[model samples]
Target: MKNCPNCNAEIEDNFELCWNCNYSLTEQKIIDIKDLNENKKEIDCLRCHVLMLYSGEYKFHEGPKIGVLGNIFEAFVNRESFDLYMCPKCGKVEFFAPLQNSEYKFE
Candidate 1:
């Protein structure tokens, strides 16, 4: 276990970001795709018919505050970061959870 530098929360060593405070251990505020893996295939937007650009990883600081019902739903889908992608032609965005200990597959 490791302590988060920002929130001082105990976190597993395998985690790169903190679950409590959403703090990233890496110095870069936004992770660069080039630094990850060059061989990762690009995603094409369905509407635009053009390659989508990797934006960055996104983490929520807190569960969204949309009132009582939103709070209940937040518990089910909380403390997760997603890979963000944007289509230049249509300005459409998409997100996916990063795979762990596995190869990225496009379908």
Candidate 2:
């Protein structure tokens, strides 16, 4: 196991980049991306009770500045991308992670 220099989070050896802070272990620098969130799941919207549409992905580029809520997501999602869902009825959006040990790809 290794620790990320930016966040000091424990990281497995298999991963090249630090999932917690997007730190590249080899490059020793932060990587850049348009959006960190990668849409990879499909589900029903809770409020509208309708199937949510699979939206595109997003990356933080810069971490959220909203304080606790933002920090929570930063920790949960780490630096890995996440999937997004939008309600067709109410336009509500949701985020989720890709399944473990699965070959699911974004369509």
Candidate 3:
């Protein structure tokens, strides 16, 4: 295990990024997460009432099935992806659809 220099959190050796704090072990600094676009909306955590930081994109993958019918059904299912955001203070996570594909607009 290794300790994150930024947050002093214990992390696994294989992981390059610290989960508690967005510190990059390889870069030896805190990562600066960029906005998705120029008009990207700032999300605040409901519990902490603090700004949430964009973690990364996550995608759902099809898992192995037990039968042929299950495999067929899985083929027709659309895998969903979302942008992950986490509250820095409370560590609460929230998922949002990609900004470009979302129908809801933020003012």
Best candidate, lDDT: 3
What lDDT would each prediction earn against the true structure? 0.64, 0.61, 0.72
Candidate 2 per-residue lDDT, tens place, 5-29, comes to: 9989887776656655667787898
- Residue range 1-107, candidate 1, lDDT tens digits: 88887768787776665545545687624344344435544887889666666767787655466776876677676476778876544567898877642455555
Candidate 1 lDDT (Cα, 0 to 1): 0.64
* Rank order (by TM-score, best first): 3, 1, 2
Better of 2 and 3 by TM-score: 3
TM-score of each: 0.44, 0.37, 0.51
lDDT tens readout by residue for model 3, 1-107: 88889889987786776767768888888765454222555888899776677767798866666576887778766687888887655678898887665563455
Q: Which candidate has the highest TM-score of all?
A: 3
Model 1 weakest 10-residue run by lDDT: 28-37
TM-score of 1: 0.44
Q: Could you tell which candidate, 2 or 3, scores higher by lDDT? A: 3
**Candidates by lDDT, descending order:** 3, 1, 2
Model 2 gets an lDDT of 0.61
Q: Higher-lDDT candidate among 1 and 3?
A: 3
* Local lDDT at 48 for model 2: 63
